[model samples]
Target: MSRIPVLTPETATPAQAEIFAKTVAKFGKNPLLMSTMTNSPAMMNSYLTLFQNLTDGRFDKKLARKIGLAIGEENGCEYCISLLAAIAKLQKLTDEDIELARHGKSTDAKEEALLTFVLLLVRHKGDLTNAEVQAVKDAGWSDEDVSEVFGHLILNFLTNYFWKVARTDIDFPVLRLYDQSKIARGNH
Candidate 1:
């Protein structure tokens, strides 16, 4: 049971419906996250803006999907994990690739470096060490790439936080998230 009602195109305001329409055109469906976000027009606009910037930015679509999968796993957000998994599949990500992202790794060296930075960023709440930033840059990422990465991270943060607060219904294919800490404790 979601704490907040997930608005549909019929029930949403004109501005909210516009967001949903755009989402449907892009992802082929209006995800419940954006639907529930209609409660705050500011957040909805911000999310849409950030999403557009990242999608059109320097990162490859596949790389961005990997980063989103990593964020879902790190945050232990079931809604996000499922949503990103579906998007990743649509983006042609293999199960192997999704698994690697969940573990904060990638066969591509540059991608791995970005994932490592994101893992550290999420774990430390953005208090990245200078060396960590330097390492990401060493992997051929520019300062602009760093900024775009932050945009993606912020988007993930918003999604995860919204899920925590609103408990929106998960509309994507069901996907499970691993508890990294419990795995570290040898409990999984």
Candidate 2:
């Protein structure tokens, strides 16, 4: 059960209702995060718009999802990790790739470097060293690419933080790479 109640469309304010409708129209379902944003309707609209625009058919969605999953793992957000793992699979990411990304490892050098950079950013909350930035650049990422990766990282952080606050339920399949026993032992 969720620690914070999920606000359904019926219970949402007018602003939230519209956002919920548009979200379902676009994504085929109202996302769990949106459902949890009922307390702040304006914040919900802003968040929905930000996410929609960020994912608006520019970059490879699969790669973005992989980045999100990797960040979720690093953040230890079970709900976000599980949801993005499912999204990665739906985007045709291989089981091995998903597992690797979830653990912040990737077979591709560029991807590995990207995840490493993201991990450093999350670990330090943007207090990245010059060496860290140079490592990503050396891995062939332009400044624009780094910025895009940061955008996805921010998105993942928002969702993961919300999940942490709401104690959201896992609405997607658990990734095989996640060891439930270890999580339980850690009291997470």
Best by TM-score: 1
Q: lDDT (0-100) at residue 169 of candidate 1?
A: 69
Question: Each model's number of backbone clashes?
Answer: 0, 0
> Which regions of candidate 2 deviate over 4 angstroms?
176-188
Off by over 4 Å in 1: 180-188
* Residue 91 error, candidate 2, Å: 0.6
TM-score of each: 0.89, 0.87
Q: Write the per-residue lDDT of candidate 1 for residues 1-188, one digit (tens) a residue.
A: 66788887678888777778777776677777778886777788788778888888998888988898898788867788788888889889999998999888999998999999999999999998899999999999899888888898999889977776677767878777676452232222
Clashing pairs in 1: none
Error of 1 at 22 (Å): 2.9
Per-residue lDDT, model 1, residue 26, is 68
Clashes of 1: 0
TM-score of 2: 0.87
Residue-level lDDT of model 2, residues 25-86, one tens digit each, is 87678766658865677777666677776787345787787788888887767877788877
